[model samples]
Target: MESLRAPPTAAGGLFPPLPCALEALPLLGVDFSSAPSRQKPVVLAWGRRAGAVVKLEAIERFNALPTLAERLSAPGPWLGGFDLPFGLPRSLLQAWGWPLDWAEAMSRYARTSRPELQAAFAAFCAARPVGQKFAHRVCDGPAGASPSMKWVNPPVAWMMHAGVPLLRTAGVTLVGHAAGDPARLALEAYPGLLARAVLGRRSYKSDEKAKQTPERLIARKDLVDALEQGRQPWGLRLRLSHAQREDLVEDARGDTLDAVLCLLQAAWGAGQPRGGWPGDADALEGWILGAGTVPAP
Candidate 1:
């Protein structure tokens, strides 16, 4: 049976309309990779702000993390949501006697080998109780994200180890990292949060080509429609030709859609206080763009 959940229109009334169209900004959403491949390259969903709508500009690809850094560091102004952890769990760092300062901790973390990092994380989990095997960042709960220390089943930790270093060297300011340039705010983005809000748990895209069935396609179209209509979850509308929409929805990998979602989230956060993140966000646990109060169960 196909995995699916609530459709996009299931809760369209839950959220208020987003703010009026944001000032034009170069928006980006990245689906990163620790070890990029030609077959499955890192994808950037690029967008540009038009008068009252954000337009899908392109689906950019990167086969290496270093090259991505170079592009980001080039002389330009851009704001983006990266689908990677910006910081490790404070609890884990404290428990392991690592530096409490976000910058210092990441400085050390960027130097560790994947094998060593995996073994250390494994040992940490081994010493904990079953229910508490993984240490979590404060942002994890509200963002509906997995523990950043995880090494398998998505391996976001490795994504962090590989990606954050590039951002640090990119000459661009990270919204949750430190203040440098307002025009180059790089924030951690979780497309899953927005997806869940709109579709409740619908399975829209699959990485495996064989699993890209008609149901997933319909789900994608529904999601795009909701975004176009400026519905809840976010009030940002996206504009693209029917061909672009078809291209975005046809990719079984969903990388393009993930990027697009991140781009919209970036636009939504642009006019908020500190780009929709709180003042305390500075490295230890950066927040996702649209994560506010979680709904009560």
Candidate 2:
């Protein structure tokens, strides 16, 4: 996970500067997709607190977004940190003459196809000077994330498009977007935020099997060690069995690790009041859970 400092671990499991609080809600971290498949399924890391430590219960994967949505909509309570942009950059939406309100913007966007979205974004960039093509949202700078509208490289723009609407379909309240259900709350999360905090620009995983190496494997092990020892500046300890540790290390795609990062973030949020959300959050521009300040230019 990517992250920044300026916060410390507190009793009750709050991660300061982010308003995170601790609790034992059914915690989850999701790595999502618009077109989910077995090859690259939607991954979820599920866990709950066991006395002083968090015990990861399971790692679940689904190849279809609709199926996952059905499961998320099931009754009772759960909270999750999803790795996708909850809102678009306000400036980018305005330039495209799209709706500025979060609901409207998302509704309009969900109707569009990936190909069309990419073409439009490319055309806009083509007309602009180099390096000034993309407009950013409030969280991008502080979160150190790519512009939400970029369609290539990481293709986060498409991710936002495919992912956020699922919360609505599942009737899971998006904390910043709608009146959230305490029973089923969904918040934005980026595993990179926390991973960066721990590793500091150290490369960890690769999709191409050929790129997976012993060095990267060692890096992953080191990361797990830091997490297990309660070394987070934020101060939450990850308690895993020897088998669990091996499972996390064995998965080279980093999907399980990313979900675990999101899991920790959710664990922190569960500990906070109102999920450690700041009062200044806007309905139009969703804020990241751990970010202290708004994203900059």
Candidate 3:
């Protein structure tokens, strides 16, 4: 077995610089979501090793757009397993008449304001029957997302609208999209899919400080053990130490857990073709802009 202390190196040199060495370690899982305040939204990149899923790194919060730009700009061959919605529901798109392609739809969506988009979506939904109004994107079904365009669902649509462009601009290759550069790859990942599979309905993390209790710690430990042993149906595993486990458990919001989940998604993507996603054909779509479905008002 390889020693955990050994640094991860790539074909050219050590990966991700020494400071971000852990991130370079292969089989990194990530969980990303926007932590938005009244001022600006922060993109939180959470990571964990594939084998030792329990151990998590600190939340790498990027507050400014420039910082995110710099990180995305950094030399890569590094795959990012982002938690944002990669596709919109098919139903929503047809109703709204947005561009069907991923890149084109995003460009059109970006031009509109939040309120305008919300109003437009609302009007569309209001006319439809209550239960069937909100449409899910292809990714949302397996990933189980709240309607892709829902504002309360942490503005994931906005995240896709705002963030995907940056990845494209950064020259990263979206795994299922047209490859602008062979070196950098972006893949759609959902940590919840993995988490639910292993520990259904059991809460693994909490943002509220009060939820970080002894019981949750034990649950996290169990979750970590399962991943390390590749006990899940997904064949995922984690590698970590006692101290690392304690550290990850201490932060209950599951930041570390989420990061590891993202890492796993990235690893899954690495095995697929440049223009394809890792899962079944029905679950994935080619890199089309505005890929998610729009909800009716």
lDDT (Cα, tens digit) per residue for candidate 2, span 28-123: 889876677887788999888544477788989998888898889887377789988888877778789988778888998899888898888888
RMSD of each: 8.7, 6.2, 8.8
Count residue pairs with overlapping backbones in model 2.
16
Better of 1 and 3 by TM-score: 1
Task: Let me know the TM-score candidate 1 reaches against the reference structure.
Answer: 0.87
Off by over 4 Å in 3: 1-30, 35-59, 210-215, 273-297
Every model's TM-score: 0.87, 0.87, 0.74
lDDT of each: 0.74, 0.74, 0.55
List the pairs of residues colliding in candidate 1.
none
265-292 per-residue lDDT for model 1 (tens digits): 7766665655666544435666777766
TM-score sort, best first: 1, 2, 3
Better of 1 and 3 by lDDT: 1
